[model samples]
Target: MNANVSIQSYGLVAEFDTPGDAMRAASSIRDAGFRKWDVHTPFPVHGLDAAMGIKNSPVGWFTFFGGCTGYTTGMLMIWFMNGFDYKIVVGGKPLFSPFYAFPVCYELTILFAAFATLIGMCFLNRLPRLYHPLLKNRRFAAVTHDKFFVVIETADPKYSPVETRKLLETAGSRHIELIEE
Candidate 1:
C-alpha cells in the first residue's frame, strides 16, 4: 500500500434497526431532493418504492414492441414461404389465412416478449456488475440477514456531510458511517 494514497468517499451509509426506521430515513432523504440514494434490506419492504419516489419502469413497453415485431415477422415469413414463394395449396386452404399462422405468431410473440423482458431488465438495471463499494463494507453484509440500511451517494449534488448525517440521525438511524470508495 502507498502511504501517500488518498482515500475517496463512496457515500454515507446509515444503519437502521428496523424496516420502519429505514423507510422513514429513505422518505426523508427522498423528500430532501437527494437523487442518488438507495436502501438495502434483508427482504422486500412494502411501500418502499413509494417512499423512495421510484417511478414505474418502462420494461413493459419493450415487451410490447418486441411482441409486435415478432408477430409481424412471423406473419410475414409464413406468408412469404407458404403463400408467395412456395405457393403450397394445402387442402385448398387460402394462401395467407391468419388462422393458419396464429400458432407460429403466438410462439414467436412469447419468445420475443420473454427475451425483451430479460434484456430490458438487464439493460435498465445495468447488470453484470461484478463489484460494488457496499460489498466491501462489513456491516452491509447484514443486509442479507436482518439489518436495513439507507445509503446516500457522495455524488449527489444536494449532499452535505453535516446536513445529511443530521437528517439520518433525526430519521432514527442507529449508526452512520462514511463509506470509502
Candidate 2:
C-alpha cells in the first residue's frame, strides 16, 4: 500500500465461520434478487450450487458442438482427398470406407472437444483476471484456509450497501468488510 494512494471499494464482503451459515447467506442473497454476488469456502460444500441457483455450465455445449464440427470436417477431408479427389485405389479396398477413417475422426473429435471445453471454461469464468479488489483484503486470505465468505459486488444495479449489510448481518456473517479497489 502506498500512502499517496486512495482506496476504492469493489464490494462488501461478509465472512462466516461455518459453511452452513455461509450457504444460508448465499440463499438469502439469491432470494433477495442480487445477481452480482458469490460465496467462497475452504472446501466444496454440498448443495451450494442449488442454493446459489447456478445452472449447468455451457462448456459442455461448446464441447459437443466442437466435436460435431470436427467429425464432419474430418470425414469430409478424408472422403474428398482420398475417395473423390485423388481416388487412391489400394488392393481390394474401397477408398471411401468408413472403417478407414474411424481412427482419424475419433482423434479429431476428441481433440476439438477438449480444446473447446478449455476455451469455453476460460471465457465463461472471465479468465486472465490478474487482479481483484478482494485480493487486497487481509481477512479474505483465509478463504483458502478455513473461512466461508460471501461477497456482493457494487456492480449489481439493485445493490444497497446499507441494506446489504443488514441482510448479511441477518444471515449470520461474523465479520464484514468493504473491499477496496
Score candidate 1 by TM-score against the native: 0.93
CA lDDT of 145 in candidate 1?
Answer: 91
For 61-146, candidate 1 gives per-residue lDDT tens digits of 98998899889989999999998998978898998899999999999998898899899889988996888999999999999998
Task: Give the deviation of candidate 2 from the true structure as CA RMSD.
Answer: 2.3
- Per-candidate TM-scores read 0.93, 0.90
Best by TM-score: 1
- For residues 6-74, write the lDDT of model 2, one tens digit per residue: 765789899999998999999999899999999999999999999998888878998998898788878
Model 2 misplaced regions, further than 4 Å: 1-7
Error of 1 at 29 (Å): 1.0
Pairs in clash, predicted candidate 1? none
Span of 10 residues, lowest total lDDT, candidate 1? 21-30
